[model samples]
Target chain A: MKKLINNPSDVVNEQLLGLAAAHPELHLSLAPRYVCRKDIPQGKVAVVSGGGSGHDPLHCGYVGFGMLDGACPGEIFTSPTPDQMYECAKHVDRGAGVLFIVKNYTGDVLNFETSAELCKMDGIQVQCILIDDDVAVKGGGHTSGRRGVGLTVLAEKIVGAAAQAGYSLGACADLCRRINQNGRSMGVALSSCIIPEAGETTFLLDNDEIELGIGIHGEQGVERRCMASVDILVELMVEHIFSDPEYVRVAREMNSASGEWEDVQLVSTPFSRGESFIVLVNGMGGTPPGELYGVYRKFAELCDEKGVSIKRNLVGTYISSLEMQGCSITMLRADDEMVRLWDARAVTPGLCFPSCDDVTSCGTSNAD
Target chain B: MLTKKNVLIWFEKSADAMAEHKQELHLLDAAIGDGDHGINMNRGFGKLALELPVMGAMTLQEIFKHAGMVLLSTVGGASGPLYGTLFLKGAATVGTSEALDASAVLTFFDAGVEGLVARGRTEENDKTMYDVWAPVLREYELCLEAEMEFVEILAACVCAAEVGMKATIPMLARKGRASYLGERSIGHQDPGATSSYYLINALYESIRE
Candidate 1:
């Protein structure tokens, strides 16, 4: 367990200090900890999302100009408490309202639900959107349904863009839900990750085996397969995503009108040929950009083979597991609204899709 | 009646219990769920140990409420909410009383298990804390019906708690992260149930002493 740290207990805080120093534009609060943008525009619908802390540049890093207004991170792989979420919503709420983009983990769901109740009690108009787009999960009877994975990154972006464009709280919540319904993600882990306090690998695996259907946490995936080449790996994952049946699950959303939680039924249509996709090839912490591009290469080649169009793509280590050596791919079947939202200008500490608004610095007109 | 002093002792003793069994719980969960149950439990109880002094002026219900709030904010995993809900709901049932009688204790435990069922969305044989809690509640109720003393009722409940903890070894998990393993989750004792056993047994020990 060789790593850089002062103490196991101080890992999350010390690293968050580093993040605050590196990106001074984002505000950091240690007590009831959460990070929000310093210069939030007035009257914009606030978008807040968070989960466990190990997945960096995710909920926190995506807080900036055109994305999330704030993020509340929990312990390494634990859900943040309701106080943090409640405080963040209060800090970021600018009279329009706040929307919480929550993942589908049991702890996360419960904590966020508790936070929504608290916020509603205080007269805040809050709505929640649950993202459960992992295609690896088949059903949702007695178990927690699909785990929210890579698609969360897309949701924060697209929904953030909608809010920036003056979408109301209900409209932003509905748009995020629509994005969730149109996405699927699948991950494979080649190695186990260690939590800072645990100081041990989460799972032991053979040198020639890979874990499939993995969530971002260090938990073991659903299936283990013998290792294969990158092409075969990407092909297997794409099949897992494309062939997944229509996923129907019941998720709770806070209804602002009645101040009640409604069990909403959501269905995700399976991927098919001739469909266009906004694709993401995400490295699970340990994989480098060069290898991710290698994955994107195979993924793009497969898309070409299947006659599916790649409308927009991001190949990076964005949504990550904590130092796990593998990659996950997310494909959001695109509509015109989502595509346009994807192209919106985003400038966060973790992600940057800037529009370069200052045209005067360009066009080679320096002689004037 | 369980005194406020005994409630504080239970919390302080449970902190040590969590620390003592931390490694064992971590190893058990490592085989099935993510290996953090022990760490989360220790973290939450360690805070409770420190917060115990400030709760001196509070009633039995207030102590439970404070403990519930501490667990809710400090513990991060699924165990946090489940245990937090247990204490908070238990506090609501015990009322603002300075002491809880034997039946009040039983009612307290029942309310907690009910909250666990509602929050975890779980049932019997789901390989959850409910596995241990359900049996403990049943045994406590039976002992009370048979007109046992308070000490004897707690003793029976603790025994039932241990049996329930062991009963999870053969369960095919249908909830939480262990369910992801499908068949592979079998043969491992559940970490959540084990921690619950420690806490429940700690309460009985505190009262006995």
Candidate 2:
């Protein structure tokens, strides 16, 4: 119940204000509450994404060059309202168009869908792509579908790079869809974190137990088990993700041509040997890097044992569950194009790639 | 007939109900979903309670639309968009009239429920707010077909919503965050359905006279 704060209700707004002040590169709109790049290059397809506020260094932190053009943040652990998304898209959309990268949560899906409809009504071209990359939730008729976790970070970076490279809205959306279908994530929680509003931990775990397949929002995971060695835990998570059966789920997407929403069947193929991946071993805000590296050390060895290649690796607390003590592992199988885009130059508060090092790779060598 | 004052009273009562039961809703959600349903619903409805008085000079249609936008702007969750759309789409069924007859009430709920279904992509048994909304709309239709008074129809809706809310205790959630629990989601009443019941019940209490 005790944490540093003036008022619980004003937490989100104050955080946004502080972030806006710290990051001069972003344009912060307090009324509708969205953060977009101060200067989106004219005619570039605007990439926008948003969700609840707890997962920091995510939607907003990723708002910058070669990432997202804009991000709408909602209350802690709550989805942003449609007006936030609508206003953000409107602010960021240049003459080209706007692409909405939505996670597959019901709140995110509903709010973003409504916002897209509103944006389209204003004659702003828009396309929404949903990210569902968590392998923990079994995909079926009687489930909420898989939750979008760590892969959202990857999708934003790759899709953001493509958009920055002057890809069409359709092309950027297609790349995002491909990334979602190719990635899977699983997380484990040593303990749950307290929500500021509730002033209590979300769930209780015995001293000798941990929750497996934990969600990012402090929801209960699929299973609880006695504490085990890091090696065993990491291997178990890796196996669950690598051997997940063909996942099929129906997602609602907007059909730009007909201006109506349509159910699109999305499938994620199981992982195989010899595949390359961009892997992320993320912390849940509480875990320190020393421990994260230990987890990654075991994970990297496991991938090598399985004959899979880690083309690029990121180890940090990029997305979190507000001081929850846990970590998630995300692995995205990347094709050549995806790999190339992943390396494209970009700069943001949470993620950074200096273009000063490489010239032609970012296509900046051409006459501007 | 249901007047704009009755509608405003419904919102005010809903705000009070959510505040009174905030802890209860939070407990229900904590069992299977994130423990914020109570806080979220209370925040949105409480805001509406404050915002409703300002609509005194407006028509019923304008009131509903303005209320929807306020909820849409303030409530930050699945319920925000769903409940917000319920009002916005229902406003489409209402005209500039400050008073609505029984048929108008039926038409309004029918459109509102349809919007909830579309927005939530939920079926009747999905263990969502639509679970309560679906049965309430059906009860409204039955009451109207039976040539009942507006008060009678509201009573039927309140009862139907209670039954629907209780029915969710055994449902395996097929939508929203609770569905992530799989079978673990059973044995608890849905928070969304519970909140929805309060809303419908509040309407009956508001216009009991």
Candidate 3:
């Protein structure tokens, strides 16, 4: 209630204006609240994404040379209007096609579907890739699927690289599926967020409480109990992701969908690792990057124990929950070609990769 | 009594009650669900009050349909869609009827409850809106079958609605955010049912006038 702002209603618009002013390389549309690259490449595949506001530098900051083509930012923790997303498709259309990266939320899904219908009226081709990487809440009949968390940002990054690298619409979309399939994310929220208009916290939790698998919007998680040591929380999150049989099936489908079968890249060899990936350690808002990296150490330790090679690592506040303290870990298992795309250099105000490296397949833990 | 002006009065009274009890509703939901029920319902009814005067002497069905639109566009949550659809479905059944008699009112309420069931996909014991709606509908039908006068019928429906609302206290939630709490959801009253009772109370007060 006693925070800095001109007005509650104008908070989202004012922040978007500031974003536009800071990032000259991105195009900003006020009506639709879309942030797209200044120069949309002609006849190339376009990656479109969106979600509620408050998770700044996500869909917007990812709009750069090697990431998302456009992002439709909506109201705080609410889905954007269908017209907003439809207009985003208009501005970012490159003629090859546009791929919509949608999160797994009922409102988000319904609004995106409405936007897709509008795009179809214009004879533009589009496909949807739903990111439901959270392993918790799968058994709940109330939810359509698990919430999309850190994997969404990673998927946009990987698939954006593929689209920027001159891949066809179909090929780019296939890569998106691959990224979504092989990735998983889980989060814990130490506190709840305070919506500006509401003038109070969205939910109140005791000082010793933490909710496991909580979403960025402060949506109820799979479990709520007294807080525990970071190691125990990490085990619970990782156990569900690594032990689920469905996760492996999804990985298999992704490998084939991205056309890895047609290419000779599926095999492990001396020259390159069969597959490499970047580990994304994301902090919900109010959590510092230092703490995020602390969680990242655990992700790295787990990958080493499992013999899964991690070529690169990203640890920071890529996604946030508007002043909620917590962190989510996402593991993007990438193939040979995917590792190359991920290694490609890119610069944006929100995310930057200034360095890249290649390593052997499977366990390189014994090395360094 | 039961004039169109009385309908307007009922809405005004309900808005005041909702405002007064807003905090209590929020506290009930604080444990099992998001703590926005009181504010959300109050806002929905507030908008309904602002628009009721402009309904232009339409039939009860038309008036309800207009009220449904105001709630759907302004409420901005799950309850908005569910409750809005309920009213609209009820209006659809009444369809240009000039007046609402005993049996006509019962049929309309039944349609509204059925619409809630379809929208939420919940059943009688789901610890949802139906927990209140189903019992109120049953009592309403009985009153109509007994050939009770309009005022007496309204009183019966409101009493039934209250009983249904309070009955939510002991049941386990089977839908929405409350369901996520499992056994923890048992102690708190269902916020949706509490709001539905206010809606029914508003309807009865309108007729009693």
Candidate 4:
């Protein structure tokens, strides 16, 4: 309610306008709201992902040289409609094809599925890779299964790099699926975020309480308990992620041959000892960078004690939940290929890796 | 006793009802879900209202199809596709018809409910809009069998919808965002079910007017 905005209804439009103004490399469209990279490679497979607006630097920030080719942002905490995705894909798709990186919420899933159907009807080859890497929920209970969290940022980068390397649409989708299966994330929120239109926080917590395993939409977490120190919180989240059971669920994938959705069974492999990991300690908007490093420091110590090697690490506010004060930890079991892909240079408004050309002069700009 | 003009008027009344109860629906949704059902429904219906002028010139099936497209494109949540599919499938049942009677109305509701079930994959007692829609369809069938007047049958259906909507208050949600709350989801009226009751009540009001 106390945020800086002209009007509640114009929040998304005005914010998108600001994004376009700040980032010259991105193009914004109004009739159907979507952000696309201005200089998309001529024939490479296009990667597109999007969700609600509060999770900024997510679907849109990842749109650049080596990330998503386009993103379709919906209203606050609402999934984007099929028209946005369909039109964005049409605009971005070259001769090769377009890949949709969808999160695993019911509205998102249904809307993207409809978009894929629409694209296919127009003779564009579309493949969808769903990310559901949050290990908070045990299974696909009443609501859709595990919600996509921090792992989405990593998926966009890795899959975007693969697409940049001229991988086929199928190959990019396959790699995205593998990344989704190999990663796990858990989060805890100190407080709830206020949706702009609602003009109130979604939920309330006491000063000494924290909600554990929260989705990004400001939904109530799975469990609430007395607040703990940063070290203890990180340890708790790490333990949950490491000890979570192998998750198996039914997912829908588009069959390009038949142009229909086919049910595909997906399994998330459990974390094991002696595996190398790409650890991401992400802030949920309100948390400071120094605190995130504190989280990373404790998380790294716990991983070392558990015999898991940290192959690579990123600590920042890459994915957010409005201005909610919280952080999430994502761990991807990294193989040689994943490591290489993760290391690939990328330049986007949200994430920028120092290129070989700039490293000599810039001396490593702080990406966070 | 139902004409294409009546169907159009029903849609207009439904939109007005959604606008009137938008805040009430949001309050109900706030208790368990993301709390935007009212806003989403109002936006969808508002868009449909804009197209009403064009829709008035079309066949009944065409009007329903156009309304479904508008809802699908404008509404941004689960209700978008659920309600969109309802209208689309209902449109298929009355292709190019200028008017319909009690049996046709029954077929329309049956197809719409079937489409909702297919899209949402929800069973009975999931505490969704389906709770109201399924019962209203059943009551409509019963009223028809008893040879009631058209307006009387619609009134009976609206009453069943109201009863079904209130019945969701004590039921645990097994689908959509409300399901995330587990046991806490009980004791709150299902927002989607409430809007569905408004829609049915609007239909009754339209015919009586």
Q: Which prediction has the highest DockQ against the true structure?
A: 2
lDDT by residue (tens digit), candidate 4, B95-121:
767888999989988998897887777
Q: Candidate 4 chain A: worst 10 consecutive residues by lDDT?
A: A354-363
Worst 10 residues of 1 chain A by lDDT: A359-368
Please give, for residues A55-171, the per-residue lDDT of candidate 2 as tens digits.
Answer: 989989999989999999988888899999899988999988899999878889889998998899899999989898777777556777778899999999999999999999989
Task: Give model 4 RMSD, 1 decimal.
Answer: 2.7
Residue B171 in candidate 4, Cα distance off native in Å? 1.9
What are the lDDT figures for the candidates, one per model? 0.87, 0.88, 0.73, 0.88
- Could you give candidate 1's per-residue lDDT for residues A175-277 as a string of tens digits? 9999899999999999988887878887777999899887788555558999999999999998898788888888888777788777899988877789999
> Could you give the candidate ranking by TM-score, starting with the highest?
2, 4, 1, 3
Per-residue error for A93 in candidate 1, Å, reads: 2.4
Between 2 and 3, whose TM-score is larger? 2
Per-candidate TM-score against the hidden true structure: 0.92, 0.94, 0.71, 0.93
Per-residue lDDT tens digits of candidate 3, residues A227-297? 98877888777776666545321111112233221211111111122446677888888888788777777
Which interface RMSD values do the candidates have, in the order shown? Answer: 1.4, 1.0, 4.1, 1.4
DockQ, cand. 1: 0.53
Q: List the residue pairs that clash in candidate 1.
A: none
Please list the residue runs of candidate 4 whose C-alpha ends up more than 4 Å from where it truly belongs after superposition: A354-368, B142-149
Candidate 3's C-alpha runs over 4 A off are: A6-10, A20-52, A59-132, A136-145, A155-183, A189-214, A217-236, A244-279, A311-313, A332-368, B1-14, B57-66, B88-115, B141-152
